[model samples]
Target: MHASITAAGQAGPRLPPVRNLRATTTQAPVSQTVVLEWEAPEPGLAMDHYVVYGAALSDFSPSQATLKVRVPWTTHLHSGLPADGRTWHYRVVGVDAAGRVSRFRGSTQVSVTTASRGLPRIPAGNLVATATSAQQPDYAAEFVLDGDPATFWHSQYDPRVPMPHALTVDMGEVRPVTALTYLPRQDGEHGGTVTAYAVALSTDGSTFTPATTGHWWALDTEGTFATWPATRARYVRLEVLAGYRGHASAAEIGLFEPPA
Candidate 1:
């Protein structure tokens, strides 16, 4: 039969060569100081260091025996960690150079929690405005004190003096603030020229009523800085008139829950 088909095509049956490990995590429910990534295995064939393991998802396991880290490859950040909520399990191992170890099993499972305090106390006074010559570094102003004389209100700004620079907080009674958070201050000198801001809600703080008159918002940028969402009124006033060229700073001010 043609010499047995050329000896079975020169004895074709030597299949055994497949190696490509992987471990990735760029985004997920993860948020605690997360940053674990990897992908390396194809060059000179001498990998001899790289092992990272994690546990806390109700006892996750992969043979249960991995926590080594020793390679030329790097990308790790598992800092602090302890919001008390758990869901963490990562893996990456590839030891060569004689130790002979290759394992890359991380199907993705990161859900570490803690980071949502949003509105608790926030009600001290209101004095986050600096600009002695503002060179940079000064931002802290936030207030929502409802004493209901009519609905007290105050929003400060200092471009050297006058546009809207007032600060007050008494909160005697009116109770109805839904949201307010401001913390802008890196130094002074208009601190990066503050930039777009407004929040006015009164029930008796000082004869005021203009809860966002047309569409003005800029809490300083980072994540949810100015949110009235519905407007209930109790005395919440934060006004930086405009910033980001000079003078505008805040440190703390948050008030929430009061819409219906």
Candidate 2:
């Protein structure tokens, strides 16, 4: 007797199809510096670039949107924005080389404010500079003087000297200073070296102790530049160690202080 086996088989279990999901944006609450981030869709899918959209919350929508320039990654930092007390809306999308675009992933809102305006206010203070002399023939070539006579160095050279000279300004009282800016001598050949410069703290302008010391280099032909620091000082001094070869020239000086 020949026996044949009848074909009897059951269908395999059906599985769900993989969905093409959009990416999402992960950003912190509104701040001066906004950090926008997102995640990849799948393990093997490559993201070629990202597009960021931002607008005022009042006007933000899918059809009406402001697009930032496309970036190469999923994260970006938007900084130095105006603190106008307005809420901003942001969204991100991912793009691939195969002309495939991921759905919008992340959304956020942020607020901005001026760093100085937000700080506490301090009592009004006086800025004084004392000088020994106050006479110069070439006013155009010499540094402009703007300080109290008791504490600042005054140029006193008579008109006989055609070349203008440099002057020192003693910042009176120890106060916090965030930035110091100065103009270099105009005559390129008269490039002088700053022998010693310091931010000092003084109860009285006459007595000054160096609080901070900085190395001085030759200024470029450009008019002026600035130095920034994290700490504050009461007084600042720039001593002339050497002068340029040609007629001397100097310009105004300024100091920037953060709010109390």
Candidate 3:
């Protein structure tokens, strides 16, 4: 017999697919740009677009999302949502290019609360190394948390480097964080930019998990951001999934308080 080890202790020391299918509550960020990514609702449906519905009532249906947007395929970057700082429930549905709505494969409902922070924003400081997990960039990662909007953490301009550059950030200690704002390089050029990405939270720097897998919107705007359910953790990892221009960069990162 071979005894093995893995990183599966964050979600209360158990994996997903609990017997209970009760609604789960998540906190949205104070920022309007929110990323909603989920496992395929149903496989082999040839889903064309994904629609999200958000409302104060948990009973709200996908048709009553009040604020609905069709993402490209299976994920969406719900931008411009009003930051009312209230609890909102979101439901996702798939629609084929032929205008056919597909059925969800399984439970696909999540409760998310908008950022409700009354105090000012807090700086997480420089805690991420330049190269982490498998990335070892020659440039220093300290440029990311230096609180300088003019500076940025840059990776070697290697378009050949397997993308989705993953950078694990440490918060010094465990703290309740609700939102993360990514300030793309405000410089005129756009070679080193992260267009799409996701984040995972961790209490220990080694073992990290996302409250729920979330999509970081494309770095179109100079100072775009994403807010999810507030979580207590000492580390956060940003995985650049797609749209890597030439390198991965960040002008500034803001870790918000419990959006209460």
Candidate 4:
């Protein structure tokens, strides 16, 4: 009548939360883009993936309502967010194969503010663009002012030019420029997307003065805005300090004028 000895089942190893979670946001043309990055936890059982949660409220809890994405890597780019000048909060958690999830708490949360969607873009008909280099007849500099978001200006690739690529546009005449919008390549390709940049204005196309400098979120598919005090310049230059995949490209570059 005695029962055979039974072996107890062991539980899977506990996984720890990610560390050094960081975030950055970019105010894009149609939305706010957020880039989140973090370091993996101490070596342990492999994780199936990581879940990203986001909300407009700082005290929001991580749940199905706030779930943003599930990724297998340490970095993620969340786009198409509302650009209503509100602070966005984000959290990340790890999940194992057995559906075990890491703890969700304040330690892994980060936040960023979305900027207002600025003025409308003016016509680019009267502008002419030139670049430091070009790939060929296919991706020349003139495409940036052609009013076509499908075509773009790509830097030289045959010889494999280095970074710091420059694209200059003559607005036909010196007009009061309040802001500039840079539309990234729209073909879903990540290469040649500007990350760090500096904008300068020149009245004579030779003498230039720095207007503003900043960084755009990497792999952002929407347009980026750079504002400066109303400056009169015939030429505007977009200097690519750094770009994704060590290349530079732009679909369109347009300027904004003060409200009439």
Candidate 5:
């Protein structure tokens, strides 16, 4: 039963922009993709959505001509971008139901450079995969290369296998390998997503040399790229050193050749 009228020309409260925005890039077969992630401001307030802007310049203004997309979530993937070794700039701002937009600040912007053209994806059918353990029928090792993110390869659960699971793939012939792509299970649960890993290469499958080793983002759901100096090998091995919940799983795995 009580309402107060505001004075004319007085500005209303505006939503605060997101914080700690960061970008991650993954090199696909023909193109490069960037994933934008940010943390919502503390004491979350309701907003209609966020507008993402992209341009060739970092200090460019945000307007209709540079606007790229409107999303309701805190993460977005910019895909199908040409791998021309050009840097791309991005900015995001929060918009409320009243059409009032948050202040455009430099802290909310990020930049990523697309890699040069790379070799086409190696044929999945040409790969022969084997794993240390598999859930069987439902979550088998072969599923990782099926080209479907909907399915995944999970370690044995009935016996409850522990971490340090390994997956080996034979390319059927020796070829130059420049990178490895790992796509975490996208079904929403982070139970078995890999956290730390190591990759090895082998020509006779009996002797392998460690190629690269690193840790993936905690609970990362997007594709993670691991690159190293080009090496020729017929067999590739992935060793999972740690997982989110003491388990290991992957939706898809791919190998890439050097840029041609």
Candidate 6:
């Protein structure tokens, strides 16, 4: 390889960087793990080491290092990563036999989600009413975030109060929201469960673009969470498209960052 490189008139001791670093999931009947794979760097470069840098959403900084792992340049797979239902970011770099590091290559911001990380809920934010019903005025929207799951907000039963009832929340400032969890009435009955809903995001609370849409079963007493790609926004609107048992109620609404 050295003779060929010299013959080709290339002069460099620094090895070429790795390319296409990614995580591939594999199952083995009873358990599963992630396999980080990559394409070898350009030929003729005598690579001695390969390094991987990774980060999670909560403490990641592109400008500074977070975590590091190194291996020999002879192999391409980094296996046995636990599947804990978390999203991860990764990159790769190469080093020459002389210990000089090559320029980083492949995706510097490649993101992956592992199977073991469950839906991670962050702190809830300020709640506000966008549309309200006048029928059940005592069961107001403010009751949802007041920290009591026993109490709930039920849209008015009046025909004029509108069908797809909604409530918008402001996070106090712009933030990257990755998942949302909606708690049901929590009384073990489907008196006012959200059957189908659409969620929207906005920066100024005036304009919104739909982000996620899904349904919940009347028997989903524990509630369910829906996730979307991480998006930066200050306001979130949960539009209840359908209701069960003639009441539109929520015990709690949670916002979460993408799992680590």
lDDT of each: 0.40, 0.40, 0.54, 0.75, 0.75, 0.61
Single out the weakest 10-residue window by summed lDDT for candidate 5.
1-10
List, residue by residue over 1-87, the lDDT tens digit for candidate 6: 222321111345544556666676664321245567765576666666666655444233322233245667533343443333445
Error of 4 at 187 (Å): 1.8
The candidate with the higher TM-score, 1 or 2, is 2
User: Model 6 RMSD to the real structure?
Assistant: 18.9
Error of 3 at 171 (Å): 1.0
Q: Better model by lDDT, 1 or 3? A: 3
**Candidate maximizing TM-score:** 5
How well does each candidate superpose onto the true structure, as a TM-score?
Answer: 0.24, 0.34, 0.50, 0.57, 0.62, 0.50
* lDDT by residue for model 4 (22-66), tens: 999877644578889986665665766777777654676664445
- The clash tally of candidate 5 reads 0
Candidate with better lDDT, 1 vs 6: 6
RMSD to native, candidate 2: 20.2
Q: 50-115 in candidate 3: lDDT tens per residue?
A: 555554445543332133665655555555543444344556555444544444224456766555
In model 4, residue pairs whose N, Cα or C atoms come closer than 3 Å (at least 3 residues apart or on different chains), thus clashing, are: none
lDDT of 1: 0.40
How does residue 149 of candidate 5 score in lDDT? 67
Q: Which stretches of candidate 2 lie over 4 Å from their true place?
A: 1-128, 132-174, 187-196, 215-219, 223-234, 245-249
